[model samples]
Target chain A: MRWINVLPGVLVTFALLLPAPAAAKTELYSALGEEAGISRLMETFLLEIAADERIVEHFIDTDIERLHRLLTEQICELVGGPCVYSGEDMVTVHTGMGISHAEFNALVENLMTAMDAEGIPVGAQNQLLALLAEMHPEVVKL
Target chain B: MHTNKFVGVALAGLALAVVQPVYADQGRFIATGAATTIDGAGGGGIVPWATLSSYAEEGQWGATASLTEVNVDDFALSVSAASLTFDNRFEFSIARQRFDLSTIGGELEQDIIGVKTRLYGDLIYGDLPQISAGIQYKKNRRFDLPSAVGAVDDSGLDYYVSAAKAWLDGPFHRTWLANVTLRATRANQTGLLGFGGDQNDDYKLMTEAAVGMFINRHWAVGMEYKQKPNNLSFADEQHWRDYFVAYFPTKSVALVAAYADLGSIAGLDAQEGIYVSLQATF
Candidate 1:
């Protein structure tokens, strides 16, 4: 086992290097082009959700206009932008939705597509994804 | 005798058997699942990771079919594999491994059935890394070569526990994945040359690891190392390693290319090769 000891070292490194998303929040917020950019991104993301049949059913009865505003504000606050989120909490909003993991993932992919369309850098996109992925437990109770 | 058809039909049947009970879809994110290993486990080419196969998230069934080829200096190996993942937690896999001895002019074959279950945590989320426990049951169809080479058994079982983690913003701010696995086994040359031997008949604990980063949503590159036990005295087996590039064009299809250094095979040294695999996820 000449190289047997290498993996533990690498695993420890990966563990220790888990980035602090808070450290780069404002910079990331700026990278997402601030509130206007986020608003544009939200528009694109909602359009994607509207088009995708897998997840569209979840939002059919909701208010798209208010949902758009709330998403924009939520993302703005999450990225450390100036705007504050005024929407209901994730669990509260999603409590009775019965959202499955597949639907959650589908929406995440749509958001990724939206970010790509917005021309967000991969690094910035990942940063945002890390923040949003945290809501998975809250959104999909199962 | 017909390894391809056998594995394909068996795997597909297993998947369809479970289809009526669960909704199947590409639920997980792209490249989140590990590639199918030669041993028919979900992981890198040689080492199994904690991540399950395919894009099956919770409450979904994800099925896949894969074909892999390894052309080495002394041997050419082909593996036909398929797996079904359910509820993002359990994986059932089957594979047919054919090891062709290019120099010896004979071939060795085996069929493997594996089951893996997620024990705790999420691969990309929270404080703990994703952890899983699995077992592979391997039965060698052609045992003559193994028997002649001091192998003691025609079949064996391997049990393993693995932990894996991913950082969305890692080195270079790209998504990175790392995994470590510990396996207990007595299989010789991953069971193609049989199980147990004159040198060691008891199961030994072996460590395997894999690490890689997704350069983007569509492409990833990584490397793996698998430690093997020296069960047979006739040929001193060395560990195996490989560096691989994986491409996931969509959630439904994946392709992997790798350069493997198998170290030694039945007294043959420096057995290196090119490994290519194609996988389809449903």
Candidate 2:
């Protein structure tokens, strides 16, 4: 008997017909700069190592720019992007460095810090490191 | 078949008797320091194949006691271990294992004492789980049995170091964990460690790897593959492989169910059987 009551029902019907809200998708990699961001993070990581007196000698005479490119390519390949890494095999690159487990661990810590500074989520950081950890036996002698 | 059945029943009774006393809710002595779940039955500390030691905070101590029995047609093994941990980071353990062989009609026993240190990382790390190292010195206990197999030595030293990683989410997720352990030892056999043989030829450069998934907080399923040397004059030893499922209603109570495919024992192929374990931790 009330036209106002019918109007409310009509509004409810209209609302039900509208599309539902979309669900959020899980991202595989960080949204920040993706490639560029990763490159910058790697640069910062190398810089930290360069500044550390304990490990600076390992990268003496090294080309930071080329290392950055190769590392970026490697990360991209590992994170499901379209990139091929032509860098030296992990064992070959680290051969005869006499790198101790402590040094390798220090490098890992530096990388983690750099990743944090770039705002990479903890999950993504771990995912990236897991791909690289297979080199432990080759990189650390003891 | 009847004799084998009778032996099985006897072994089952022994297992029941050995495990029942340790089932009390509290104040029962338990193995503390060494890896708690090293046997693939989830309980407290990490097993060799599970994640490494992420011992709890300082002054938190853990102790555990375990009994294991392995029986075949001609041989039987009984192993008991007690260990203590300090600060969840350092552990000391003592274990005794006895082997009785019908073919030789003799029994051998050994006492093992060891210490473990958590090097780095946690059991379930946010980024990279922890890594740890352990070394055990085994002293042979003197005993006399029917001597048919040559004189057996009971004392030896063994060492192992391992690294592990846990994933919160990925293809593996929180349910997925991986570990690799390198062990060097001069012991004649794996004894209770899962493989067996003599001290010299039995000394092994071994590797153990495992992957586990927690179905829920209180339950987990995992598989362990161990590679060891075949060093026995009496019989050729086969590599060890086992798949196990564990139930933990609480951190202090656990039960493990496993089916072991023990490749060869005394030159027999495919010595497979089921294993069950119940453990209480304090």
Candidate 3:
């Protein structure tokens, strides 16, 4: 009887030593494409921003295709993907635009609309906005 | 069309009667529990009490009424107020406050109108507090008093900046919230408009600080202390102070009970009383 009790304890100890279940990796960018099944959402978002009347003038001298690529690269990096943005720093890019606080806020609203149109989740939008908010002081004159 | 116009006029009058002197803004409802204290002093200044309702939504409206009493020497002062707020960010309020300088055996009263605007910060921000700036205009009603004290001016203006911060550690948080206010006004009179006289009508700065703790979701308690400069010559100008406990069942309704000690008026010790108020918002 004493030997049988010892065998159960030994089996329980072995089970406790097994490795834990693996954590699911975050699928940020992949969610927009694989999970949401929208491969062109990013492109559409960029186009909508470019077409917005309130902020489009700032991009007059920009090359659309080049700008699109830069934005895609930035978004990919932001979403934990393997892409490095080659665009200018925020201050350098926005310095000449002379953006007012109101105009900047309007642009932010338009960007949010575009993100929603592309079916970005509220949590994802908030994360993206938090990253962008750091540039408010540099982008807005007042 | 005539009947519609008549009805519109009647409604406008009713609106004026029901409105709190302050107004609200668009896309945002005024955050409840954000009213300045009595005498247009806010936070811990002179009066530590606050309104029950938050600001109204853009198209919504709100109203408030209050009664305040101060006693010093032979003088007893009482103030009654009605205010309205519209657009959620702008506010207008009117009040009638009276002074019964008992020792002098006369009555003095004034009418006050005020407007305020939220300049920066949001109520929901955990890191930042809500802030607002406002201006108040006071017009004195005609009265006869001893000429040696000086004449009462019919009008004067006061300006202020106020801020409120709430802690989010839930009801059990030891210190749940606080507010600070700074106001600059001409020392004209004490009760409603200006009580001291024209000679004392120079701009004086007043400051208040307040702290609050929540006992439960619908109940909280707070204390405030206010400081003011001595500008009157008739008597040692008393600085106003008070402590209050409030009940808030919802964002739209609040009741406050307080103990006030307004140091002295006209060189008499007039420093203790019980105060009560009820505020409603929509």
Candidate 4:
């Protein structure tokens, strides 16, 4: 009752200012094509990362096949897919890895480019990036 | 004409421009709460939000400098400001404004010093809105006419609390940001006409809001509305609103343009015009 007078103002402003809300028809996982689609996305992402000179040296000792499999599983689970992530947590896997801020940003840039090339929607791509952003503390050693 | 204050701000900004920033934690997303408001706060064109001025993450220092010009139908106002944010938590700012009443053939000037601190929540990472509290201390330099026209004082302080929330890719694959603020103030015409008046002297609670959407990583479009307190009886004061577009070509530089409606100032009705600002941060 106390908010009745102001409610109309708020509603009208929100309606006029915001874009129309998107329908909730698809989960984030489904938007990225579930497991099979994730695999292809990971393939493109990994290939681009390999070619990136800024972060390539850090991956010299990494196991590419294992890394790819774990990435696919991790992403699949993170995005509401059914896959289970059996890989080590970000901190355990990345501690002492000497990851710098520039390297991390470069990695994200490569990931974004790969997503664009793979036809991933901008929303899905940003969602994925948001989830990954939480892992920065664990991944960045410096 | 207070040309020295303008030159001082410009020189300080130039000095800051030459210092190379050393980033600590590359925290926060790109283009997150990156625009600077006309009042030297982090936000949209007209209203201040709860976000920090720039992309500086926790434990990092960020500084921003901006110059803004607003040309209304009967007047022209220019603001020069600079702000320093520390650890994405505390913000300190100083701004000088020169208002030229072209129609009246006179000018009014004011200096504002402000401090803001984040109290709780995060703008992007959590369910709760980011909240901040701030105080702006304003002093009018040219107030002889304002005092004669029923203004009670030439100096006043404004206190405000703001909340900002960001939803990433929540709708239409675009990031949306919404902010609300409650300010307690006695300033008339946002302090250009000084504080308090013959009709009313008590501080009034005012509401302001800003809603925006990120067009992409480097561009944003938004609208803002700020309520004002009508303290002076000589001329009825009105709320302010603007539709704005902000572009960030690089992480350090941002440009904003808007169409602002300042309602009534002094006695001029429908003071509508163009607003443009340039800001650089590191």
Best by DockQ: 1
Instruction: Return the TM-score for each candidate structure.
Output: 0.91, 0.53, 0.54, 0.80
Residue-level lDDT of model 2, residues B33-143, one tens digit each, is 112443322222223632322223344555656655555555555656666655546766676777665555556676777677777865433455567788777665653
Tens-digit per-residue lDDT, B205-255, candidate 4: 999888788877777887788889999999999888888888765556667
Candidate 3: segments with Cα more than 4 A from true spot = A1-142, B1-31, B34-36, B40-54, B69-75, B102-104, B146-148, B170-175, B188-201
User: Weakest 10 consecutive residues, lDDT, candidate 3 chain B?
Assistant: B22-31
Q: Rate the local accuracy (lDDT) of all candidates.
A: 0.86, 0.55, 0.54, 0.79
Chain A alone, TM-score for each of the models?
0.88, 0.74, 0.68, 0.81
Pitting candidate 1 against candidate 2, the one with the higher lDDT is: 1
> Candidate 1 vs candidate 3: which has greater DockQ?
1
Q: What fraction of the true interface does each of the listed models get right, in terms of native contacts kept?
A: 0.48, 0.01, 0.00, 0.22
Tens digits of per-residue lDDT, candidate 2, A26-101, equal: 2444442567776788788888888866578888888988988998887766666667898987788887888864
lDDT of 3 by residue, B97-182 (tens): 67766665677777777777766664433356678777777766754452345544556777777666554332322225666667
Chain B TM-score of candidate 2 stands at 0.73
**What ranking of all candidate models by lDDT puts the best one first?**
1, 4, 2, 3
Score residue B93 of candidate 2 by CA lDDT.
Answer: 68
**Residue-by-residue lDDT tens digits, candidate 1, A44-136:** 999999998888988879999999999999999998888889988998999988888778888989999999999999999988988887888
After aligning candidate 2 to the native by TM-score, how far in Å is the CA of B48 from where it should be?
Answer: 2.3
Better of 1 and 4 by DockQ: 1
Which prediction has the highest lDDT against the true structure?
A: 1
